[model samples]
Each structure stands twice: as structure tokens, then as C-alpha cells.
Target: MATATIPGPRMPRAMQTLGWTSRPLPFVERAHAAFGDVFRIKIGRDTFVVLADPADVKQVFTGDPAVYHAGEANIILLPFLGHKSVLLLDDAAHLSQRKLLLPPFHGGKMRRHVGLMREIAEREIAGWPTGVPFAVQPRMQALTLEVIMRIVFGVDEGDPRLARLRTRLTHFLETTATPREMRRLLVNGPIRAERRRIFASLLDPVDAVIAEVIADHRRRDDLADRDDVLSMLLLARHDDGSPMDDAELRDELVTLLVAGHETTATALAWAVERLTRHRAALERLTEEARAGGEEYVDAVIRETLRLRPVLPFVGRRLTQPQTIGGIAMPAGTKVAPSIHLVHRRGDLYPEPMAFRPERWLGVRTNPYTFLPFGGGVRRCLGASFAETELRAVLGVLVSQVRLAPSQPANEHVGRRVITLVPDRGGEVVATRVAPDVAMPSAA
Candidate 1:
């Protein structure tokens, strides 16, 4: 019946803050090395109780969602995700919204987007600065955004509205999701208000565009046969036969837009960067794909996600008093399952630092240990959609494009929002393979 203090660095708060913001991976690795599985670290005004052990991670992820409120811990994302966004809801509300949204991104429903993904990737990659070095992350972002707008929103590819909306979205995402912005929002009052004002101004047009799209969908009778997510969402009814309202629909659309695109873009960039560096893996993936199979491609993606998890941490906050990792967690305490550290644990992964896709051959990975998509109730709703996109994009690119790192040095990890991005934006030169060997024309 006693609360035990979590052990961590005795270093000054300033140093901890510095390490967390500037270089999170090394900061976490050092903390876990010094304090073992569970430790405490401060970022801005928050104190995070970090856990890397699989047992602790399972408890945090699989525990009652009522007790561990993912929504509360993600308050920073609320402005971007919107007031009614499913990502910011808890318990019953969260469950209801999730049920409404899951069908479009699940099983067979999600596989329907593969052709869209392949088409987007092919068109975008066709224009890559071939025979010259360029950052592939921007290209990847463009490709994923196009897929989201077309496949998720039902937007026409060449529509002027689509272009205008993309500009606004990129501006909103770039302006808001940064470490400086997060810290300022946490602690700075005046700046935060100014930011809120600017953010509202930026968001208004984007909201308007989404509303127009939803309205247009309502007017159109030809959509019942459509496979796009927006169409499905428009037609979807709850258990009691209620459909999402205009605001709810728009918020969820924005949620899918932001959440669906950037994370996959970052993951794809890392996959390319990793594959180009590891020749054997690259060869195996290419050969496997050429043989009319994607088993090795799946392995490559699995390895990429494990090595460079898009979100460095999966966060949750306690709603009531509970014990985690044998340490007392009072209500309102923040906890982060360190995805970065757990993926690199020597026990879970042999040669944890190396990029070896074969490690997955005939291997069964525990979901808690290999959680790039997270676990349980709050796991990413678009997990299957994202995986399918990655596989489609990777299969196409690996077969048609011959690519390698622009510089001899390895790409360093960089932070954007909460995702780890490739340094210099996964810089590489892409060239076409021989005509006979070019990726089979996008289906």
C-alpha cells in the first residue's frame, strides 16, 4: 500500500528536456540503460513514466481503456485532430466512433485501396529526379497525400479544389506539429493563443473544403457502388442506424487525412532508406517480388517498422490510481510505452540494430513486442490500410526503380511532429530498371 518512486537520471531538468526534444532515441536508450525497464523523464511541463519491458507495455496497452485514457495523453494532438475526432475520444464515445470508422480500413475493405496506392506511387515516382539525388520523403508524402485524397476522400485527382486543399493541409501540418510548437503550447500562454488564432484561420478553409466534399457526396446518387472510404462512411449507419453528422464526418475526415498520410510516408521513406543500404535484403525483396510473391516484401516492411517506428512512443494517461511495473501510478500520471527501445531489445530481436529482413523468416512476433501499429482498443484504425499501402508502394518501387543512398554516410534519424523521419529526407537517386524488368504496369 505504498507508492514507489520510479528511478531515472539525476541529471538537471534542462538536460533532460534538451535530450528529449533534440535527440529522443539516444535520450531514451541512455535512460533505459541506466534505469532498466521503467523510468521517469520530463518533457516541457509533463512527467512521463516510461516503460520498455514487454510486460509493462502489454499492461499499458491491453489494460482497460477506461483506466488508461489514451485520449487524455494525446491532448497535444487535439487541436489538429479536432474536438470530435475519434483519436481524442475516450471509452464509450471512442468505441462508437471507432465502430463507425473501422469498416473502411479493415480486411477486404482496405485491400480495395491497393490499386489506388499503386497508381499514386507509380505516377509520383515516374517524376522522381532520376539520375540525380533527391529526398524521397517529399515524394513519398506527395504520393500518400494523393492516395488519401483520392481513395479516402473521393477527390478527383486533377480537381483544382484538391490542389488548393493540399496546400492548406501541408501548411497546417508543418506549422503546428513541431517540438517548439508542442512545448510552447504546453507552457507558453500568449504564443499559444496567437498560434490557436492562426491555426483556426488555416483550418477554416480546409474544413470548408471537407464540408463541400461531404455535401457533394450527399447530392450524388452514383456513390453507392463506390469503394472509397468517404463514400462508405457516408453510407455507413450505426447499430441504431444513425449516420455521422456533418461536423463529425468532417472531423473524422481530417483525422484520417493527418493520421493516415504522414505516418505512412515516414515509414515508407525509412523502408527505402533501410533497403537501399542493406543489399542482401534489397536483392531478396526485388527477387521475391519478381517471382510473383510479396512474402519477403512483407518481411522488409516489418523490419523497417521495427527498426524505425514512425511514432517513437505510444502514450496513455491513468484515469485512476493503478500499479504499473510495480510502481504506483496516481490518476493523471502519463505513461509512454517506448516503441523505440522495445524494438531494439536484444532479447526480442537478435542484432537489434542491424537491418536483417530474414529475422522474420518463419518467425512469430508477439504483437506487444513488434507494435508499430500499437495494440488493443486504441491501436491505429488504419493499420491494415497503411500496411497495404506500404506493401503496394514497396512492391512497385522495388521492382521498377533502381535506387541507392545519395551519400556514402548513413541517413540519421530526424523528428517531425512525433514521428521519426529520415535525415536529409531519405536522400537517394532513383533510376529506371531495364525495360524488360520494369515494374509490371500498375494494375
Candidate 2:
């Protein structure tokens, strides 16, 4: 039998929404502290059952994506990601789309893009102003955005349309970075008209740019030999030999542009923030970088994801009867596998708050215990790509220039709609100081 209710804070709806919007991480931690590993939190009209235990997290991740329905769990994002997107699809359709998409992101295709990524990262890092504090997020965003535009959309660097699309998409993101904009779209009422008006205005030109790119790809004969992701997607065949329709193509492209770039930019910024404060780790990382420490670089990225996951949690809406951590839950119940809380648990990670890259050097972490990319069928398709991008970007960043924390105290993660962005935009000072020590093992 299903439990009637779970233990959660019984705060008024208004307060819950306010607390969640203002400070999501602290709110979740408080809930875990007060109610233990399993608890519930109601925000607006929805109730989510949150699981902090790694064992419980495994159940949610290992459960079939069809039953868990990751796309449905993120219905609130349809206004941005769209309906035909692989991100919003479930079960068979999701599998079909993944089959077409996976090939381009793996194998020789990924290897071919590795050098392009390094070039892009180096060029962007070269432009940063030295001896002054600047937010790394903007540069990281620009670097990732340009990389995706070229690699994913097949747009050439000199194209005027690429510049326009970048501006328009950035503007769109700015508007959507608040609670007011979210409520304008998610909630229905008299305000729905306003949301539509604004979204249409923001979306029209961006869609036009994407449409133009798609048309160009369709007309090009040379694309058969090209290996850009969009070209690959254009040529990718379904089981019955049909190509994806324009809407499907456009939606998936937009999803990649947004979903692919945003999380990575935020994560890179967080990495810089963490490194600045953890001087020892930063020094070791610099030594590794100067000495070409690929393993150490990987460790730094791994530790960054562990310490500050750009997305705080992976949520699923229960489709049928399910139990997690011994508590039975009925259908329609929403479950949030708490990534942030899980990473910070004392039992799982000693000195949970410390930033230590050395810890990951020789440890084989249990998949469920360290779920930065989530797990199971719905795991992030861009996981390997994002990690590759981070390593490439950081390789250019640390090897070429040295950075230090501009702020004495740690910067808090602020609410940015769905993403928890670094507060004060991850401010850091750029210095061209050379690393004095070389890691022989890395060399």
C-alpha cells in the first residue's frame, strides 16, 4: 500500500515558493536536516518528494526512463526546449532520437572536434583583460556558444547570421532569467497573453536564423562529406529511412544550443570560482597543466562537478506505484533525486565542503554516489561532450594564464531560473604569472 503522505515542511504555499526561489540549496538542506533523507517540499501547486540518500538516488536513476519519464518531469521547460525535442520525448521516441543523435557525439566525430574546441578556447582566453577582476561566465558562455554554433549548427565563424543569432539568444536567456518571466509562461490567467507576446517577440528572429541554417544545410551538396552535428543530423536516417522533419530538426538544434551551452558555461564559471579560493588545488592544477597533466585536469573537472553541479537535482514524476528508500509512493508523485544534497552528505564525502582535486586521483567513485550527470536511460546525452569541453577550455585557461579569487569570501550560488549560477558572476582577477613548479609525473 502507498503511504498517504511523506514527511515535509508544512509551510504555506507562498512561503515555500518564496524560499525555493530565493535560496534553493539552503532550502533543500534545511528540509533534509529537519526531516532526514526522505522528505517532501511543495512549491506553488506542485509537490516533489526529494531523496538525498545515494541508495534511493540509484532507484530513481536505474528505473526505466519510460516509467520515470524525464521529459514529462521537465514539462515546465517546454516553452524553451519545445515539444518535438528529444529532451521532451519519452520511451520509444526518445530511444529513436537518441539512436540518431548518439553517433554524432561519439567515436571519430568527437575526436575530430577535440582540436577545434581547443582552438576556440585558446582564442577566447587570449582576449581576456589581464590584472583586473572580470566574471569568467561571460567568456565561458561566449566560448561554448561559438563552439556549438560552429560544431552543432555548422555555421561558419564569419557568418553575419551567427552574430545575430548569438545576440538574440542571449537576450532571450536574459528575459527568462527571473521568476516573473517563468510565472508569465508557466502559470495561466490574464498574464498568459503577456508571456506569449514577449516569447513570440524573443523567439521569432531566433527561429528564423535556425530555419535559414536548416534550409542552407538541406540545399548544400557538400554537406554529405561534412561532419558537423547539424549535417550529421540532417543525414541521419530513421529505421524506415525517413529524415527528421524541419520542426524536429529545428527544435533539437535549439535544445542543443540552450541545454548544451548554458549548463557548461555555468559549470566552467563555478570551476574558476572554486579554484580561485582553493589556492593549493589551483597551484597543483596549474602545475599539472604546465606539465600536461591530463589526469589532473580530469580530476579538477570531476571535483568541480562534484562540488558545484550546475543543475541541482534530477526530478521525475512517478508514473506508477514505486517505492524509494523503503517509502512507497503512489502515481502522480514527483521525485527529485537531490544531486546537491547527495554530494554534500558527510557519510559519502569526508569534509564535504572542501575543494580537493587530489581525492579523485585514485578513487573509483560509485556511479550513484557521485551523480553529476545523472544516470540511467535519461542520463545527459551531452555528458562526455561537456566534460571534454570543460577540460579543453580549462587546459587553455590554466596553461596560458593564472587566475586568483577576487573575493575573499566564497561566492554563493544564486537562483537563475532553473540553474544555480555563481553569485557576483564568479568574479576573478587575471594574472599572467608563470607556474614555478612542474609536475614530473604529469610531464
Best by TM-score: 1
lDDT for each of the candidates?
A: 0.84, 0.82
C-alpha lDDT of candidate 2 relative to the true structure: 0.82
Model 2 regions more than 4 Å off? 1-4, 178-180, 189-198, 433-443
Candidate 1 segments whose C-alpha is farther than 4 A from its true place: 1-4, 177-198
Candidate 2 lowest-lDDT run of ten: 434-443
Residues 107-168 of candidate 2: C-alpha lDDT, one tens digit per residue: 44566777788888877887999998899887888889988988889987787888887888
lDDT of 1 by residue, 181-278 (tens): 66656664433544565457667878788888899889889778898888989898878898888888988998998888889999999998998898
Q: RMSDs, each prediction? A: 2.2, 3.1
